[model samples]
Target: MKKLLLGSMLVLGATSFGAVVEDLQNNGAKPAVLNIRVKGTVVDPTKYSLIVKPLDATNTTDTMQFNFDGLTIGEEQIVEGGYSAGVYQNNILITDDYKIETSLKRNGQNATTSEYDQMAAAKLAYSLGEPQAVGREYRGKVNVKATGKAKGSFVDNGVNLEVLVKNI
Candidate 1:
């Protein structure tokens, strides 16, 4: 009877170990949606155009980027900047690090006066894995030396960038 109990215990232990291994392998192998959104509002959209662009491939790791440099007040237009999510895990899309670079410019001056770069979104996505469903926001503080017609004027102190990751 003692031998029988020992054999049963060993089998049970092996079964539990297999389950743990399976869980580890399937952790990030699920279908998910990684929706990338870049949102900002113009507090004083009087004479300035907020030119925000997703950094070029060199500055980004994920397969997504956008250009919202011509964003107007209350405007939420979608502009694509050559992005593709080719990496997939268990039918879920995988993303790499991403950064958004924004500039504030005087409409008529054709010059950039202020710049902001935010990368919090990319870091968050990578940490959450493939099946993560959450949203994140990053604030970048910027100091701009007044130039062109806006000389001596203070541009906005900072910009808020947001990214959303969800499961499909």
Candidate 2:
């Protein structure tokens, strides 16, 4: 069992240390800050994992198959694919100066406790980087209510599982 779990960790959460840009389709539902968070010396929440759960106008749930690294928009017109899974890119991080640390957390406990290890949800904290932006669009937000259905691609597609996934 230990070997199996360790192997799984190797496959899923094995990033050295870097940036991770995630793309969630507009008018779609994707969970931010997935199971694993990256550690660094600048910002801890600079990157996050995604889980897309697209929905319809009437609040009906719809799923779509996405390829964050390999799939391109106009590759084909898609309606919904429940069994389909979204794509991901790892260690696609940004540059900063603040000291950052990565760990696991749940509820309100520390990130390394046994309970946090078994918890399903994790939260990441972001700190100020050197030469902070006085006023700019440092943060980005998307609406996942099934509206902006256009082209999609992941950021830094050259990396593993990297995709610029977004609707036009």
Candidate 3:
């Protein structure tokens, strides 16, 4: 009986040890960020044009290093900028641009010219453009991107960029 109990205990211990070894062999990994983009339009309540572009689209489909200058806006017409998500997690950069509640004033003593950026995942308010000239309102969409490893994880996958105007 003593030998039997010892052998039973040894078998149970072997099974447990094997299970632990199997679990240790199967290590897990973190998924990288998938993708990010920008959407929206540029609005101009000013009397001049602003230079705001989506960085650069040299290859059209190359999701690396966007290079856009400022766009132009004149009179009551609004040139919009829309931002979707990109292949990066820079939504904080987009959110950082919308801390103020009022329209960004151009100049003068009472002019409030505060702005920020937002990360890609953040539900951010689009940039209202930088106020340099007097009486100018420019609108822009901040695009962001996040990279990841897993599938359907909002990480590196498909990407698109079209100048779509919602309300024209």
Candidate 3's TM-score: 0.16
Weakest lDDT window of 10 consecutive positions for candidate 2: 154-163
> What TM-scores do the predictions have?
0.17, 0.15, 0.16
User: Candidate 1: global Cα-lDDT?
Assistant: 0.30
Computed on alpha carbons, the lDDT of every model, listed in order, comes to 0.30, 0.28, 0.29
lDDT of 2 by residue, 3-113 (tens): 989965654443212123344689657655644435433333445433233223322233122222222333322222121123223534322322222222234333232
Candidate 2 global lDDT: 0.28
Model 1: per-residue Cα lDDT at residue 122: 16
Per-residue lDDT of model 1, residues 76-152, tens digit only: 33322322222233433334343333333333331233222222211111111121212222232222221122112
Off by over 4 Å in 3: 1-28, 35-37, 58-168
Identify the superior model by lDDT, candidate 2 or candidate 3: 3
**1 against 2, candidate with superior TM-score:** 1
Which has the greatest lDDT?
A: 1
